[model samples]
Target: MISGLVQILLFQSLGELVSKFLLPTLPGPVIGLVLLVLWLVLRKGINPDLAMVADGFSQYLGLLFVPAAVGVVLFLPQLQANALAIISALVGSVILTIASSAFIARLLSKRESHE
Candidate 1:
């Protein structure tokens, strides 16, 4: 477990270094995740220890939203101030998402029928 955690952190740190030097725009954690994915793909399977560590982390995944909840609370006033715009965007995005998803599904169904 400890070794798995270390491996994860090592990749994250490497990603941070890459982010600092090579790609200043992309986030360090994202880069680190990509690196980790590539490594796992090349290795052809996950290490047992890493799988265990990931399972443990997954169990507490809901806890990760705490910070986001706190952030929303902290910016409550600002959010309230822009509620109109926020609501508008939310509704518009929902409509667009549904429309696009339906279109894609329809196209896929048609293609499948043809084949």
Candidate 2:
């Protein structure tokens, strides 16, 4: 488990380094996750310990939103000022997401039925 965690961190660090040096626009952790995914795909599976560690981390996922909640509290004034714009964007995104998901589901079902 420790070794698996170390491996993840090492890849994340390498990603950060690469992001700093080569890709200033993309986030380092995102790059690191992409690297991790590619590595896992090539290797054909995840390590048991690594999967266990990931599941453990997933348990506390809700805690990760605490900081963002605090940020919203801190920026309440700014958010209020932009409430209309924010609401519009949120609504628009939700509608778009639902429509796109339905469209994709329809396409997939059609292809699956034919197959």
Candidate 3:
């Protein structure tokens, strides 16, 4: 478990360094995740120990959002003031996401059928 945690941190730090030095526009953590994915793909599999550790962490993922929920509670006043805009934005994004996903899936299916 400790080793897996260390490996995760090491990759994240490496990502942060690369982002800071080479990609000013991109976020460090996001870059680190991309690097991790690339590493896993190149290796063709996940390390069993790391997979176990990740699974353990995934189980508690919901708890990790507790602070964010608390933050929303604290900001209820501000949220209420801009509720309309927020609701509209949320609805719009959901609709757009569904539409784009359907479009992409249709395109992919057409290409697959042709192949």
**The best candidate in terms of lDDT:** 1
Ranking, lDDT, top scorer first: 1, 2, 3
Candidate 3: where are CA atoms >4 Å away? none
TM-score of each: 0.78, 0.79, 0.84
- Cα lDDT tens digits for candidate 3, 1-104: 78777778878898899889999788888888898889989999989877888999899999989999999999999999999999999999999999999999
What overall lDDT, based on C-alpha atoms, would model 2 receive against the true structure? Answer: 0.93
lDDT of 1 by residue, 11-106 (tens): 999899999999999999999999999999999999988999989999999999999999999999999999999999999999999999999999
TM-score of 3: 0.84
Best by TM-score: 3
Candidate RMSDs in order:
2.5, 2.6, 1.8
Report how far residue 39 has shifted in candidate 1, in Å. 0.7
Off by over 4 Å in 2: 94-115
Worst 10 residues of 2 by lDDT: 3-12
Question: Can you tell me which runs of candidate 1 are displaced by over 4 Å?
Answer: 94-115
As for TM-score, the candidate ahead, 1 or 3, is 3
lDDT of each: 0.96, 0.93, 0.91
